[model samples]
Target chain A: MRYDIRFSGSGGQGIITAGILLAQAAAIKAGKNAVQSQSYGPEARGGASKAEVIISDDEINYPKIISPDIVISLTQEAYNKYAVDLKDEAVIIVDNTLVHEYKQDGHKVYAVPITASVKELLGSAVSANIATLGVVNEICKIMEHQWLLDVVISNFPERAAENNTKAYNLGIDLAKKVME
Target chain B: MEKKRERKFLQGNDAVALGALYAGCKFYAGYPITPSTEVAERLAAWLPKNGGRFIQMEDEISAMAAVIGASLAGKKSLTATSGPGMSLKLENLGYGYMAEVPCVVLNVMRGGPSTGTPTGPGQADIMQARWGTHGDHPCIALTPSTVYEQFSQTVRAFNLAEKYRMPVIILSDEIIGHMREAIEVPLEGELEVIEREKPACAIDEYKPYDNSVLVPKMASFGQGYRYHVTGLNHDEYGFPTNSAKLIGLQEERLIKKVEENYDDIVQVEHFMCEDAEHIIFAFGSSARASKDAVLNLRKKGVKAGLLKPLTIWPFPDREISEYASKVKDITVVELSVGQSVREVSRAAGGRCNIKHIYKVDSKPISPVDIEKAVEG
Candidate 1:
């Protein structure tokens, strides 16, 4: 399957890193080919940020995600801006606390309480992106959750390895408990 | 047979650094610039530990100068920067051009007239890259569209720079510089590496600027072979010359060295253009989208194709004309308002109908844009 996913948020929320780790999981651990590209406004720290990942079983010619199969927005600005370009059957994932308003008219929508879940489960929202990754993995099935864990541990700092792994598992639990 | 290697996911900038290291690059001096600072950052992290030197120069001009100095001292050297920095580097780039110092300069382009959009992607430097420096001199520039090409092309850039004893520019935009993708890269020893030829003649017989063989063999300063190297027009013995014959000879050889080997240096990838009518000529990020546009058009019962120039400079005019001769229409898609389209028009030479699909708002030209342009 060719899955085109976009992770949109304000910078420093690690959305770009999230997209990169996801592609690494698909390509390195899942044995699928993937391409991840990102763009940010001039004000890199607080500006609107977007990272696109395309994972395919076959060769990927276009390395960009023009018409997204899935859109995960962690901010109202990101959600409102990117919602119009979603695929007809796209799965829209949003952080309920941050993105209070969303329009997912033609497709499956999951308003995940990503910030609150990370706060309750991990004791801090620092790894909020990792927790959101778990929610997306559970719904989209882009790659195995185990593969995501492996990517986070290998790519992230050694000290945060244990907590990040816990963060991912907590996300999976949240996804199953709430979205089910 | 070439030994195959395992594939790994890597960012484009990291791939360039790895390729430089694998190609025996031992010196890196650069000023930080957006979309390109990662190239220097990666080199800084790995270069020193692997028997290389990484220096952060005060500015782009100093960075270019340091790379030239290091290369002349017989080390494979590289320097990376973005649009404004590249502009600041034009004088020294011209110095490297005239002095014929073997080095690689990476311009990981971001949008800019003067810091237009630092993090945004644009192909605005196509003309600046080829003509940024004063006066006319032939340049060798390569644009890699994928992470695999980013790695392999950087190695190729080193090989070309050393073989010709001139600076080679790796003109990568933000799209390829920052994108992360899975690439099958051969290990250090697996890739074929080329080193600059050392002079075999006696110390007294050496002529650093000798026009006899076009690319005269060079010996580093400490190697005991002493010779003069001035930016002014020089003679066979590297002495400044006012004689018209010597000036003409020096200018001719500087351009001829790369131009004569154009066949070997120029490379392009054709996507289903063998028997197509509408040809989309693209490079860098535009080529990636154009490839998808070509595939989509074929599925729509249209005979659309693409020609992606991996080697951007020297223009690959012969091949562009060869394929353009049979095509009914040619569309040049580039990120700039219009830069690469000029080269396409010049190469197509009025044999076919030429059209332009350009975007200069710092937004990437998606495949849908190209498809719509072709359908219209």
Candidate 2:
């Protein structure tokens, strides 16, 4: 079975990196076949950026994701951009701080205070992407929470590891509360 | 022997770069273009560590020229470009054909004729790829629909370039270019690399274009076979000749080299066409959409299948003809209006009913459109 997921946000929101992390986690760590792709306009920063990930047990025959099963939006602009494309039963997780309102319709919507959670823990907005990953990890339940923490730490350099770890654990805590 | 690690996530462009490096590509010349720039960037960072060189040319023309020049200097060379860049490189592509240089050109095609949609995906370069360059020179073009095929076609492109002493174009569209997938790349020693076959004769007996085989035993520029080379019509001694006999002979040899290798050059993939009544013909990125459409058609109880041309050039006439004789109706879908449908009609020998589904506004031809075409 193919599990297609999409992350959409402005360019600086690290949407592409999040997609890469999913592909790496699924293909490398979890040993499943996965494909990831990203799209953005010419604007170097602050433009709309989207990253798509498809995970399957066998080969990925079709590369494009026509309709996504899971959607994540960190900004209101992103939520407005892809809210209409989600399937009726698709799960959507939106950032509460940046995204004020969630589209309450056929989709199962979950609002997580991603940026607020990270800002409260690290006192910075730069780690909101890490917090979003915490939400994804709990929602998907495909990989271990510690494994994602380890992935973030191992993938990042040594000096940034400690702050990233704190930000990641904060995400895990937030996600656990949401899931419970 | 034991099996190594199975699969790892790799960006499609990264796979092409790693595959080129593994195939002994030492020289890379390219101008950065979207969907294909990552290939140049990766090679720029990786080639240096492997004792190779990477040059970002001023334009696509120079990129193509530099790769041809480096290959003549006995270095395995390559260049990457997108749609507009590929158009600019067509001039040098003709030069490579006339001069018979062995090199690989990777065209990660995005939408368009004039910088149409840089970030979008389309496979509208099929006809341009086969007839892009000027003149009647022969060419080999390989189309890879999947990322796995991207890795293998890269190695195959280099191999064919070295084997036939011609430029091979790896035509990949934006969908497969930017997509990331799991690929099991072979370690350095596990892959068998094919280098160019040099002349067996001594310097005194060396003739650049002899009447031996269609492709003469080429000697590298600095390898002591110091021979005359020109794009103009020339004799076996490589000297400029105005004689009709020499020009005719050179042209014939150039065409014959690729013509005789048709059996080895033509590649196609046939889907459930054994007992099918209708056929959908497509290639490159559009082939994936056709595959989806075919699956949906079968579910609806319509006997449909797909015919994907892996080698766009030397169009698969035999397969098309045989399938046409069997199937009652055929539909051709493409990003362009009527470029490939003409060839499909000719290949079918007009034995079956033919329909065209053209989407030329730089958008992908969806399966919904295909199903509509079939019903209409």
Off by over 4 Å in 1: B1-4
Tens-digit lDDT track for model 2 on A29-98? Answer: 7878888877777677886678888888966655667788888898888888865566777888888788
lDDT of 1 at B141: 94
lDDT by residue (B1-376, candidate 2, tens digit) is: 9778457577778888988987889999999998799999999999999989999989999999999999888888999988899999999998888888899999888877798888887677877888988889888988887777788788888988888888999889887888888888776667667888898787889888885667788898888887877888888878889999989999999888888998888888998887889898887678877888888899999999899887877778888999899998889988777877999999898899999998866557888788788767
* Per-residue alpha-carbon lDDT of candidate 1 for residues B204-276, written as tens digits (9 for 90 to 100): 8888888879888989979999887778888887788899999998899999998899898999998898889
Complex DockQ, candidate 2: 0.60
Model 2, C-alpha of A103: deviation from truth (Å):
2.0
DockQ per candidate: 0.82, 0.60
Residue B113 lDDT (model 1)? 92
Taken over the whole model, the C-alpha lDDT of each candidate is 0.88, 0.83
Error of 1 at B163 (Å): 0.9
Error of 2 at B36 (Å): 0.5
